[model samples]
Target: MIIGYARVSTLEQNEALQTDALDKAGCERLFTDHASGAKAHRPELDRLLDVIRDGDTLVVWKLDRLGRSVQNLVDLMNLLQSRGVGFKSLTENMDTTTPGGVLVFNVFAAMAQFERDLIRERTNAGLQAARARGHKGGRPSKLGDRERARIRELYQSRALTVQEIADQYHVSRKTIYSSIKNTR
Candidate 1:
């Protein structure tokens, strides 16, 4: 069976192009992921992975549709290969069932990994440059010092419930509990 996988990085992005392409390419079944490419969990992708069997073929419109990161794409490919499933990327013209296609996919996978490494390197360099300029990275605490102190007092007094404290402090119950736990 030739199973198709289509994905768009965001809710607003259209899945039409991929779907149409996959249809034209003769896919028998189709799955999709509507979340961002960087997200770790894609429900449709997971579902497809769970049911895909030996001798089945998985097809995608493009390499990016499979994954945004090199490690992710490589991992998916390895998993499919281990399960005796063949993979085909339309835009990249890769097919795991053929020897030449295997070589081409390998080279493409290497290049994707190299590109990701370069992105990481550049990001680290940028962060280091920002730090040298005395720009902190993380967001400041949402609660003011005085409010935190008051929260600690109220929590230690045992006069307020977690929910009440959260209400008074204008924060979530989880945040209130975390604050109390941290102070203790």
Candidate 2:
């Protein structure tokens, strides 16, 4: 069975074009969603995944319609392949059921993974260089010595509530509590 999936980012956008293409491509069933690709949950897509069986092919008008990013596309392909299902992208002319298509998809997935690994390596190297320069990587402290002293004095005097001190210092109640604990 060939199942089609179509998506539009906003309500104003129409899925007619994708649906027409899918129908022409011999899609027996269709699922549609009016949601952003960046959204983590897509109801119709999830339903299609749940209902598709082994040996079925999942078709999309375009590769981007199925996933938000290259990594996401690769992940979805991996899942479908693991389940013995195939994938086809109309615009990309990709069909995972064929040897050439499989090769192409594999190459794309490898490139995405390589890019992610390179990014991670570069970020780690940058962080290590910063640490070597005695620069820590968290947010700078919001309260200084004077503020800390005032917080301690207020708490010790029991004249102001934690919330009151937080408002006076433009900090959060949690910050006031943490400062007090550090002083102790």
Candidate 3:
């Protein structure tokens, strides 16, 4: 039995490419997920893993369709191997049942890990540089310091209502309250 898996990063993304390849490769059933591959939570993949029996071959259009991380791919492969289930990747031309496939998959896994590490190193270096320049990361404040001060003054003086302050700042009432709390 050949069970295929397909995945896409977003709800709007289509699964045609993976599905088509899986079908062409003689996949008997296909599971899909419309979630980021980086996310650890993949319901469809989990479901596929649950009912897959020994002698069943889990097929994916590409290794990346299975996971964005090399470690994750290796982990999944190990889990499948322990279950006595085989694995195949259409694009990578790999089948775990074959000696050549094992070698190719290992090499690909190593390269993927190297790529992920490089990205992590570069991102950390860039973030450190940005911090040195006094640049803050993450979501920007709903209101700037000047706007918050004005809101505080107006609110204390009863010159502006909470609703009015919120409207002026183009923020919700909850955000207005949170801003006040931060001031304290």
- Point to the candidate with the largest lDDT: 2
Who wins the TM-score comparison?
2
Candidate 3: Cα lDDT at 152? 81
Q: Give the TM-score of candidate 1.
A: 0.65
* Tens digits of per-residue lDDT for model 2, 90-170: 999999999999999999999999999999999999999999999999999999888888899999999999999999999
Q: Tell how far residue 85 is off in model 2, in angstroms.
A: 2.7
Q: List the residue pairs that clash in candidate 2.
A: none
Per-residue lDDT of model 3, residues 66-165, tens digit only: 9767788888988998898999988878898898887876787788788889999999999999999999999988788988888888788988899998
Kindly provide the TM-score of model 2 when superposed on the true structure, using C-alpha atoms: 0.78
Q: Where in model 2 is the C-alpha error above 4 Å?
A: 128-136, 156-159, 182-184
Poorest lDDT segment (10 consecutive residues) of candidate 3: 104-113
**Model 1 worst lDDT run, 10 consecutive residues:** 175-184
Task: Give all TM-scores, in the order shown.
Answer: 0.65, 0.78, 0.59
**Which one wins by TM-score: 1 or 2?**
2
Each model's lDDT = 0.89, 0.95, 0.89
How much RMSD separates candidate 3 from the native structure?
A: 5.9
Instruction: Give candidate 1's error at residue 37 in angstroms.
Output: 8.9
